[model samples]
Target: MGGSKTSLAFLVLLLIGLLSGTSSDAHSLSYNFTINPRPRPGQPWCEVQGEVDQKVFVSCDCDRAEIKYLSPLGEEVKSMNAWETQTGTLRDIGDLLKEHVSDVTPERHMVTDPLTLQARMTCRCEDDRHISGSWQFGLNGQMSLHFDSENGHWRVDHPGGRWMKEKWENDRAVTEFLKKVSMGDCPAWLQDFMVCWEKMLKTSDAHSLCYNFTIDPQPRPGEPWCVVQGQVDENVFLSYDCGGAKIQSTSPLGEEVKATHTWEIQTETLRDIGDFLKGQLSDVILEKHTARGPLTLQARMTCQCGENGHINGSWQFGLNGQMCLLFDSENGRWSVGHSGWSHMKEKWENDRAVTDFLQRVSMGDCRAWCKNFMVRWEEMLKSTASPTSGPPAVQPTATAIGFTIGIAVGVAAGFGIIILGWIIYKMR
Candidate 1:
């Protein structure tokens, strides 16, 4: 079911603030369901929202039996093999709450007059590596009852909840079901979602592309003489074997782009750049490591176009994959990340031709390429069943009954475990 505090709405706001400041390592998943026993003009009898890592991802307009995905991640979830089962679970939970509406509301407020019920279930992996889960139920935005996995007991938050608490606490089956769901099912689902999320990050481009070029002054017979790897949103799309003068596509997008005129131009240009880098590295090795031996050089180019139409670009130079110099493509300024590279930075900063070339390539060619590739990729995906986007959905408030601690921090941090008994869905 769901959980909340004195004022469920207010508690939701407070928890949002706390969650925002939480350490990056912490992750959470939650679902909130709202039910209207007596519907008015256009209000639905039940509605559900599913959130992952604090962002609303999926929602169902139960009145119409329609589901809307709020983000690309949501689309990925919808495409999962278990998606139908997941949605079915949502529908069942909503229906169950509607059927048992009176059991969760106070006797005085159980009249036929219009009344609203809100419940939330959540599970989280905290900064300290502790896993917690909770369930909260509220009527008309006021929290009534909650259950914490740690305590394995139901507590009445409002006097109105006394009747429901007494009824649920005595039922051993209900208690065990809540406990198993919050502690077992929820955490398992969260971990599985995180794995899918990590995979998504590597395969999809949210907004950016990066290319890394590595050149070796002395390569073994079995090694690549020089190579360039292209990545879109951290996903390697293509690789160029500089020594063999071959370009290998690593992804569908990359394979499609290979047929474009720009691909040939890009391959030739990268080969030229690789030669230029090898020359520069030879000079640097002579100056910095005459007695130390051969050194590899690396160049990384990155460009991104944001929602506001701003194109940000940067170029980085390093030795053996250790970053040393950074070039701001917008201003044509060169800087060194490490003091040892200060000499190289000073030499390059004084060359007007080098600065102009770097600036021109980043702002002109790089920006154009990034925008072109992204548009093509988007159009290509849109034509298929790839991740789709939808309008933003409102966030849901979370409430929970915590073990050991009574109110304030404990209750605010607690989240419920969601389980729809009829639907035995396994997260893939």
Candidate 2:
């Protein structure tokens, strides 16, 4: 009887440990809106999609101007103090944007065929206590202009953005409004949203990790450094400098991983990959560039381990910010993005050894690494502080607002597999 009671006490303590160890994950509040004066048969004139941490919570379209809650969490959002005001404001912004689009230019606002404007605004608060905000505007699905709200600067991306920048940059009202909204109002709204989403935003048991390596062909004199950044979910945990041969921990989770044997193996693996990639860059630059001032090569490997023990892995290669190749680890197939690089695809596909190695690393090795790190991740969370119990007394929400825009599709480059016999041949 006494032994059973002791066992029960142990179980109780374990449950308490689990609950106390709970830490909040990164959260984001964002909205995507599109303005199309002339809509297709099924399309809406003005459309809006709102998300909290990647989950679509609410959406509105021409069929219904009223916002519709798509998730249970979104339903709770109606109880927020400023919910009605905020929703109404969003509608007002949509109408204002439509008017603004009409006044731009004949090329943009032609009576017969008007160019659609895509806009997005986002406020993100990370577990590390970092906050980020963005507002982007695009035309005909191409990103044209971006606003840096903190500095109130408008950066022109495409030629179409030049006129918009010229019009808005000198306009103090426009700059201040963007600055006030993103730096002030967006964070305020996020704070309110966080209160209702505390339980929903808790760190999940499932684990995800990604490593992105960007290598420049002709890095400027002071910037010859090739680095690998590793992210566990949305937080950057570790970064390795290839030139300096140094590894720096960016978070508590990273510090813990640094002491393990796994870290040692990972460092060596990264170095080998970097060296292998460096050898191929010159040939690629020669082939792709007739006259190139600046160019970069990037490789990304990602893996996710679900609560159900299912694992998914992917490998992506890019040049100058354009996706060139994608590896479907599940099917062990290489997808070439451009026809110009079909030579690379044929070479890699024919080289059975190299193809198999990439599949093994992405599908097998990456999954193993993620599973091991997940244990460490859970342990680290136990020492972290819990999220604030409640949001502070609401600040006066600002009329300033901006959007977070997704990248526009571009010409995808092609990828060539690395020949790393000396480095990876031993893995077999």
Residues 209-241, candidate 2, lDDT per residue (tens digit)? 778777865554665446677877645688775
lDDT of 2 at 164: 75
Over 151-181, each residue of candidate 1 has an lDDT whose tens digit, in order, gives 6667775565777677777878666656655
Name the 10 consecutive residues with the lowest summed lDDT in model 2.
406-415
- Give the RMSD in angstroms, all C-alphas superposed, for model 2: 17.6
TM-scores of the models, in the given order? 0.43, 0.47
Q: For candidate 1, what's the RMSD?
A: 27.4
Model 1 spans > 4 angstroms off: 1-206, 379-428
Model 1 residue 6 CA deviation (Å) reads: 30
Which residue runs does candidate 2 get wrong by more than 4 Å? 1-204, 336-347, 379-428
